[model samples]
Target: MKVAVLGLDCATPQLVFDQFKSDLPNLSRLMAEGIYGELESTHPPITVPAWSCMMSSRDPGELGCYGFRNRKDHSYNGYSLANALAVQEPLVWDYLQEQGLRSILLGVPQTYPPRPILGEMVTCFLTPSTQSEYTYPAALKDEIERISGGYILDVENFRTDNKQAILDQIFEMTRRRFRVAKHLIAHHPWDFFMMVEMGVDRIHHGFWKYFDREHPKYEPGNPFENAMREYYQFVDQEIGEILSLLGQDCAVMVVSDHGAKKMVGGICINEWLMKQGYLRLKEAPSKPTPFSKVEIDWDHTLAWGEGGYYGRLFLNVKGREPRGQIEPGDYEKVRDRLIADIQAIEDPAGRGIGSIAMRPEELYRATRGIPPDLIVYFGNLDWRSVGSVGYGAVHTFDNDTGPDDANHAQHGIFILQVPGRTGGHNHDDLRVYDVAPTILDLFGVSISREMQGKIIR
Candidate 1:
């Protein structure tokens, strides 16, 4: 069967069906005709590993990528920021190509420096610039630029103070992305086609405050209050247009890597670690310094956290790190202690923070590179971890990147439809990893033995 997959980053089932069902006719129609549900995302759900997990049908451990920024090795001082090149496993598309089935991939994260495929490829957000060779065939670059004016890898400077400018860029980027996608759909020959629209994620991050009534900084009558809804509607319309391009026999699926939600605030994890005597600095700076810049007193430091949507705590194990402190036999002892302490942390309001801590090995089949001793979700994903020291207080109002209104939620969207099929169903137990195996099953491709997720069928 011909399959067309649309990846909508951060598209949540709650927002799509409960909040804006009426505004999304195309999606609503698909829901009525197909299997729809909440697709559970990866633990500490963020973009980098989430998408990679979906594409590979493997958890972060098997993928060996935990986040956008990864420890380069077992060395504590070295790290490598993830790009498309960082994924070590064979992607689903690679499997399809091996089977002699042609496919076209566009804007899928972890696809930058586009690998050679049986068909066309256009890289996603991780691409450094449009000037780089973003397409697989090399010549497809000129064709994409000619069709969409220029290929938009992603909107730059998403954290700008100018909300309107960010919105405008989102619109332009969405328009270009869909335009290119449409051109490819109509022109390219393929058994499988997939593309991801990052604008949905971008707009949510940029304007969630205006859309979310419960947001602390929300203004009820703001001009951009309907911005997120309007963008989803625009996306729905684009979906309809793409649907019209496909034949009736084709199968269609719409999925998201992870969902989005309002970010309450940030918890300064490093400061908390310091207060708990687990971390130390050479000299306290007058201002906050990044993790890399902070002169860490490793001799005294037992654990340190690197901040993101979730917190990552690394233990200075005696043999693993350069200046290790925690004894090899005490690894589990230190880890369990840190987990207990972090979980017991309370907010300034004298309330439990609702944190969840897990070792990387517990969640994945296998782990590589420098895995965090503990992965933490403060306030159950509402509050991000802030690594900067010298913030003085445990709570902060702004993200390290800038004024981000939302954080990654644990559930994204999953909708599947076969033309002429009726009696649709909804499930809450589906997961991101299930998508790859389901797609493979639909196309008669054998599921990989290494995949942890079961085929939805």
Candidate 2:
């Protein structure tokens, strides 16, 4: 049986399986006629490493890709994009290709700088633009453009107050992406096909406040209140159309990298570190400044952190970093104290927000490639980690990057429908790692010993 994966980035189980269930006929049908449940996301659960982890059945530690940006080495400024180049492990398609099977990949995260595949490929949003070689055969770029009438890599400036423009751009981008997918499925030869629609993620981040009453910034009776529901309905329609193009022999699976939840506020991690004396600056900035641009006093600083949906705290240990402050022998001792202090952090009202800091070695099977000293989830990920300093306080409703209302949740939706199989069975043990092994199992390929997840069956 052939496998087809429909990836909906940031598709929340709460919304898909509960809130908007009736509106999403296609998705509901799949859930009713298949195995469906919440799939646990990777630790930190952002798109880049999460999707990469799902495709390779490898933990972020094994891939050495903790987030969208990773410490290239021990140097302060030595960070690199967690792009396709960072992933050396073979993905599901790679294993299938070895058995002379062809696969189609479209807009899957971390696939930028599209490498040579045995089948056709269209890279993800990380592509510089269509101007770059985003297709495997190079010549396929023109055909893709012609078929989709100028493909869209991503919605530009999605984090904007201009909700209408971003929403329109998102719909158009999704429409074009699915249009291209339909063309490929009908015209191209393939055994396994996977395409990720980014609109779900974009819509949630851009408009969650309007719909979610739980959002701190939420305003009831807003114009865009139904924006997320409408988008999900559209996506379901698109999925229905795509299903029409597939033969009965094909098995379908819908998955997301992670779910979405209302973001209460931002935790200025660097500013908090400064207050804790873990991070020291050469001079106080007159205004908010990015952590990378600020003058850091490495000699006095014990730890500094970079922020996103999660926090990556790096310790400056003697003999490890230039002008390192923490003694090599005291690394774990200092880290333990910091972890305790971080988890003890409270809300403005002095109530605990349930923050926790974890050591890399404790979470992953193996620590690889300059892993952060501690991984943090501020307020259990209800709050984002703001890297900008000079914020004056630990919590801010305003985002350092831009306006965003949602944060990634720990569980994403997963639905699998196999031909000639019983439907409506739900399993709760799904993990991002299981996807790769399940794909290999579907194709009758041997599960590699290096893969960290078990087959879903």
Candidate 3:
């Protein structure tokens, strides 16, 4: 079967699977035609990295990225796809081409300067925020532009989700994305065709509350909330259209790196560090830290996870941390103390923070080469985390009453649908890494031995 994979980043199967099967006639038909299932993703399940795993069939560490930014010590900058493509690694397209199979790729995240366009590919997802720097073969540019209508134009006006005008922008963008998808599929015919929708991820961050009962800003059918769901349905309809376009002799695979949920509260590790004396700040330093300004004592602070999966942790180390003050031997003690405190602490209303603090070994078995010193699993409340060390307050109150019964914490749930069945989500399901291997498997391709993922089929 010719495989066409569509990645809906931040889409939780649980949230949409049953709903789509019951409400979306087209999707239900596809489920009946082929295999489908909920795919479990990697830990700290954020975007850039998970999608990278899908492309490379390797863990982010092996691929050399854990999130949008590496966040080593205090260093920060976004990861680019150029570095990834240079690894001499065997991507699915490359493997398929060696075997003489043609493929087309478009909008796959963490992809840049689209290379080895066996058929035709336009890298739109994870595009540069400011300008277009397409890497597809020159032969395909005209075709791409013709179909895409001169590349995706970012919406100009910015309005909060609560505003109707902004909601309109979202609706327009969603339509544009589907238009591009249909046009591309119509213009190409190959063994494998892949596309990813980043709009889902962005919309979640911008309008998570409407969907989550626990969000402080949630207002279901709130114009923004309504718009988000409507956009999702629109995507479903688009999927139906794409399947129809594919006809027979092709199998449709839909997956997401992770899903969206609310973040009701967060644990500021920096604050905890300050309280624990692991970090010290001068009333005024001659120079400010990276995140700190002259007016803001940024020496020590807490944040929700800043990178991969938004669930990472790091310590301000002696040589690594600019504001490091903790003793080397005490790193474990500090982590233990914070983990204990965070694991047991509750929100202002008396709710536990995380279920528990897990040692790196205890949680993510595949470190991907560099695991954090600690892994924390927050309870059903919204999450706030960071992957660095510092001092300041550890816990703070975030206000947002959720939907009377809307589910709050669901970033890591499993995607279970007919035709494909994997165990439901658990901390151990690292299926996101399996994405790359599965794509390759569909084409009977092989990967390097150093790669960490296995073939999903």
Candidate 4:
């Protein structure tokens, strides 16, 4: 059977299955004729690792990708962006290719530096620019540019205050992506096809506050209250067009890397560490500054953290890091202490924020590469982790990087429709890893012993 997977980045279950269900008729119809539910995302629920985890049936630790960026080694300069080269795990399409089946991959994350496959390939948003070779055959880039009239890798500067420009860019990008997808489906030879649309994620991060009443910055009678809803409808219409092109034997699945929720604020992790006496610096900045730009006194610091949607804390163990302070014997002692302290943290109102911290070894089947000492969800992901120092207070509403209004949730939405099967069923226990196995099963491919998820059936 042919398989088509539609990936919507950061697509929240609430909007897909509940809040905007009536507006998303294409998705609503899919729900009535297919199995649908929330798909549990990876530990940190960030884009880079979550999509990699879903396609490879591996956890972030096994993939060795903690977030968008990872530390290459113990050195301070070891930090690098996670790309196609960083991941070595075999994906579902890799297994399919071994069986002599052709597959089409479009905009799948971590696909930049596009590798050769049995069929066509278009890299993900990580592609530096059109100047770079973004397509596998090299000539496909010209075809795509001709058909789509110019393609956008991703929305640039999505976190800016100018809402109109951001909205326009998002729509234009989505239009081009869908246009390219339809063109590929009509002309390419394929047994499996997959495309991920990033506009869902970009719009949520850019316009969530205006639509979500639970947002801290929500206002009554805003001009953009219906902005998110309109985008969903537009995406649904695009889905309908694609659905009409698929054959009767095609098995379709829709998924997201993670869900999106209103961000209450940010917890300046470096500032909090300084307050708790775990991190020491040579000199403090008068204003907020990135942690990487500051001079750290590694001899005195016990631990440090890198922040994004979640927090990654690294311990300064002797012999592991240069001028490390904590001895080898004190590694667990220091990690456990920091975990306890980070979890016990309270919000600005003095109420417990329900923060959670865990060791990387505790979450994955096997740890690979340079894993973080601790993975944390500040306020259970209601608040983002801020890596900047000199924020004065532990809590701040302003994002260090830009004006992001939302943070990722632990559960993303999923929908599966198998050919020649009874329709309508809700599978509530689905996980991101389960996707790879299910697709393999549909195509009669053997599930590898190394794969960590069960088939949905």
Candidate 5:
């Protein structure tokens, strides 16, 4: 069976079905033709682990990756940015290759330093440069550049105030990526083909404030108010082109790693921990500093948090960390206390901010790597956690990276279309892990026992 998977990063089911359904004709037609649903993403719902989990059918713990940054060692501070090399589990493509099925993979995340596959592979978002050997066999890189002008890995420097420039770059990037994809589809022979469009996620992050009417800072008649809609429409056209290239026997599936929503603001997590006496700095720096840069009094510190789309808290256990403080016997006691306190944290208005706190072992199949003591979704995904300290206040108006306007939501989009099918099926219980098993089943391959997700069919 021929299968084509199109990944629209950060696409939301609510926005696609409920709000902008009229704007996306391609997606709408797919939903009517087959099955569609709200697919639940990984815990914290960040990009790195979410996409990896979908491809491997393994939870974060089983995959040994939590987010973009993972603990390099068991020390209190050491961390390395996660990439394709960090993923321990075998990818679905690896399984397909074992069956002698040739596949083409393009622009999937955590695929940098492209590995050898049965067919061609152009690495994903983390590719350092087009000048680098981003494609398998190396020579394919030159051919791709000659065909599409150049390989567009991703839109660079997305955190600028210039919205129009960012939009233009996303458009050009999308166009080039699709151009290359069409070329490969037409020329290259393969049983399976998959590519992810990252422009959707970039647009959401840069323009959500303008698109989301519910945002407090939104302006009604803003020039870029309809930017998101226009971009989706453009993406729909691209999807239509892709579908037209495929034969009637090919099955199609469209998905997203996670969804996006308006970010209210950022919570200064390190400062809040300091105020609660859970964290102690040797000397409060005049300027905001990252956790790694500051001199921490580990003996006095009980718990500390690293900030991102959500907060990752680590406990100073006596034996685990170098300057450990919390005893092994009291590990549960301290963890429970911290979880309770984090759940009870309030907003500036004195209203309780509803948050979900979880222990890694309880949520995933195994806690392989140095797992966080507590994983928190601040204000339940509305407010991001700021890792920088010495902000003085508990809240901020912008992201530490730059002027990002959106945060990750729990649900993403999933649509599967089989030819000659009638009466569309809608599944509300789909999870990201289910995709891998379902895809394997479609190609007549056995789903591994290690995979936690069940086949949708």
Candidate 6:
């Protein structure tokens, strides 16, 4: 079986099917030709933990990941491989390698410092802030260096506050990735060909308004989002083209890690945390002259928030935490207490909001990969968690500008976008996690006895 896994960051199952059911004459036929549905994710259904779990087949807690950030050792300043390293448990690739099957991974996150990668890979999504050493897949340094353009690019650099520019950038990257995918697939005969279209998520965050055309943030005449109906069409064309090249007998599967949805309103969790005595922002002393801004004592700051990504409540464990306030054997207790407190937290006017929090135990049960150091749930997160995120302050600053428009916010309610799949979509929905085990199942590989998720077949 040859599976083509298309991971659209923050793509809701419905978004995928709804936008393309008829538009994608190709994928629609593929659906009839195979299996499809809304796939449920473990709780605290954020990306970092969810994607990692899908790849590794291990629960979040065991994988040692909390969110995109390693709160235990660092803050959410940038992506770090520290947590990835802690995921000593084996991955789907390891099993594939042992079985002598080759696979291809494109632009997947947390797979960086990519080692033990079973097949050919080109590292991606490596941000400018990432430590040079942490971004490269140590084993494939030569391959990455050989790519026409290095494996990593400052993707956000292509983004802009203008929707058209953002769309152009998305298409540009998509083209680059398509070419790369073709190269890898042709150069190496592989069992699985996986692609993560980071652009789709970026597009959703910046253009969810396009889908509805009624939100306060909606932009008119913004060619990209306003014409988003074509985005999926374009992607479908890409899929059709890829399919044309595949062997007819191979079974095909299209999977997205998480679905995307438009954000309702911003929640100043840190601001809320400050009111709850959970976070304290260090004050800047004396107004500074122009061109010279004040500094943030990241070291001294207590409980900071990083925009919409994880929607997490990270406690600064060092100097700022209440002395002995959260002690040993009480991690779960503190976690529960935090979740409860955050749940009770209300917006300034108190009109009943749609968010919740999670304890380590709840978080532990919620996922099969690294669990966030702290569990935070936003709004109903009907599917269990909010979408992607970006860098921003607790309350101020209008990220309505720059790449901030594309700052996270994709994953949401979806597993499938069928007439009956809407709210009822559940374990019954087509799942992305099932991709690995299903392939393993077909090959006669024992689904790892320790696997948290079940076989797709």
Q: Please state the error at residue 293 of candidate 4 in Å.
A: 0.9
Compared with the true structure, what per-residue lDDT tens digits does model 4 show for residues 292-318?
999998888988898799998988888
The candidate 2 region of ten consecutive residues with least summed lDDT is 284-293
Model 5: lDDT of residue 56: 97
**Full candidate order by lDDT, most accurate first:** 4, 2, 5, 1, 3, 6
| Model 1, C-alpha of 144: deviation from truth (Å) | 0.3
331 in model 6: Cα distance from truth in Å?
A: 6.7
- CA deviation > 4 Å runs, candidate 1: none
Off by more than 4 A, model 4: none
What global local distance difference test value does model 1 have?
A: 0.88
Residue 355: error of model 6 in Å? 1.1
Which of 5 and 6 is the better model by lDDT? 5
lDDT of 6 by residue, 197-254 (tens): 6767676666666656555466677545545667778877887777777665455555
Best candidate (score: lDDT): 4
The TM-score between candidate 1 and the true structure equals 0.98
Per-residue lDDT tens digits of candidate 2, residues 1-457? 8899999999999999999999999999898888999999999799989999999998999899999888887888998998899998889889999999999999999998889999999999999888999998889999999999999999999999999999999999999999999999999999999999999999989999999988878888999999999999999999999999899999899999999999999899999999998988999787888988889988889999988999989899889887788888899899999999999988899999999999888889976788899999999999899999887889899999999999999999999998888898889889999999988998889999999999887
Worst 10 residues of 3 by lDDT: 399-408
- Per-candidate clashes come to 0, 0, 30, 0, 0, 35
Taking all chains together, each candidate's TM-score versus the true structure is 0.98, 0.99, 0.78, 0.99, 0.98, 0.77
Tens digits of per-residue lDDT, candidate 5, 1-457, equal: 6899999999998788789889888889999998999999999698898998999999999888888888888787688777888887987888999999999988999988888899999988888888787998688998899988977899999989998999999999999999988989889998999999999999999999997888867998999999999999999999999999988989999999999988998888889889988899999978777767899998899888988889999888888889888889999998888788888888888888887789999999997777788898989989998999878888888688788898899999999998876737888899999999999999999999999998976
In angstroms, give how far residue 115 of model 3 lies from its true place.
3.2
| Residue 172, candidate 3: C-alpha displacement in angstroms | 2.9
